[model samples]
Target: MAPILQVDVDALRQLAIDMAHAADTIHEFDLTQPATGAAESLESSSVAAISQNVSWSLREAYRHLAALVDQMATGTESAARIFEAAERSFTGALRRIH
Candidate 1:
């Protein structure tokens, strides 16, 4: 049987914050310098273009990842609230029964 895992909502939120910082870091790269090559040819431009495209794509991917992480954190917090409410309700019910 698989062990049940308990997650801390506050920790998840912190992780989301960390992911957002990482995404910001990735988006801060400067890709203005052209690529180095053996000769001053079209290869440099092509390489530079490709590098810029890759960097842009990576930044966008990280941005999306951070957004997703934020959503997870929010969901976890909501779930925690719901669980707390349920526990309170259950406790009240037990008190009434006693």
Candidate 2:
């Protein structure tokens, strides 16, 4: 006989919700300051460019995580349904063994 599987759908959903909320809390700092030093030296320009790139990547990562979390939360209902179906089938098989 297959092992019975137990799951806490509500808890999973809540975790996903929490993750999304946490992701939302991530705020990007202002990095729009112009690089002005030694008459716009190469080092200053490179630093500014790299900082901008890093900022953009960070924001994108946060948005991605939030989106994934939201999706997981939304899919919890479907996951619960599948689990319910499996449990029902298992119960039926057990009953036939008597």
Candidate 3:
């Protein structure tokens, strides 16, 4: 006996949409300006350098995370499409046999 595969394609598609939106939000976020401003107020070159490095690191991290999320969104949408196609194919095959 084969195991039944049940999928909610609509929900999966919505989740993909949501994930895409979240990735966009994360990618658009700016962290450098505030960090620079704070560092400038401290008036120490070492502090400014450290702050810039931290800011750059954080921004890079967020960009990487956003890219990953975008990839996941693409994968999820692809999965939903595959599932929908499979369901349609199965239904058509069943109808032809009837």
Candidate 4:
């Protein structure tokens, strides 16, 4: 006997939407100005340079994370559409057999 597989495509679609929203929120956040201000307030030039480097690193990391999340949302949305299409096809086949 084969096991039955159930998928909630609507939930997948909603998850994709939520992920896209989260990615947008993360991308929109600005960390550069505050970091630059803090760096400027520092007394030592070397320390300020390090602080700027750290800020740049953090900003890049956030950008990368946002891009990854956006990709995942796109993939999830594609999966939902594929699943829905498959389900519709299966239902149609069953109806034709009856």
Q: For each candidate, what is the lDDT? A: 0.57, 0.61, 0.90, 0.88
Clashing pairs in model 1, backbone N/Cα/C closer than 3 A: none
| Candidate 4 per-residue lDDT over residues 1-98, each given as its tens digit | 12123788889999999999999998987999988898889947788888889899999999999999999999999999988787777877777999
Instruction: Give the candidate order by descending TM-score.
Output: 3, 4, 1, 2
**Ordering by lDDT:** 3, 4, 2, 1
Q: How many residue pairs clash (N, CA or C atoms closer than 3 angstroms) in each of the candidate models, in the order given? A: 0, 0, 0, 0
Model 3 weakest 10-residue run by lDDT: 1-10
Give the range of the ten consecutive residues with the poorest summed lDDT in model 4.
Answer: 1-10
Residue-level lDDT for 29 in candidate 4: 79
Which portions of model 3 show Cα errors greater than 4 Å?
Answer: 1-4
lDDT of 3 by residue, 17-37 (tens): 999999999999999789989
Q: Lowest-lDDT window of 10 residues in candidate 2?
A: 30-39
Instruction: Name the TM-score of candidate 1.
Output: 0.60
Identify the candidate with maximal lDDT.
3
State model 2's lDDT. 0.61
Better of 3 and 4 by lDDT: 3
**Residue 81, candidate 4: alpha-carbon lDDT:** 91
Give the TM-score of each candidate: 0.60, 0.48, 0.88, 0.88
Model 4 error, position 17 (Å)? 0.6
TM-score of 2: 0.48
Q: Name the lDDT value of residue 94 in candidate 3.
A: 74
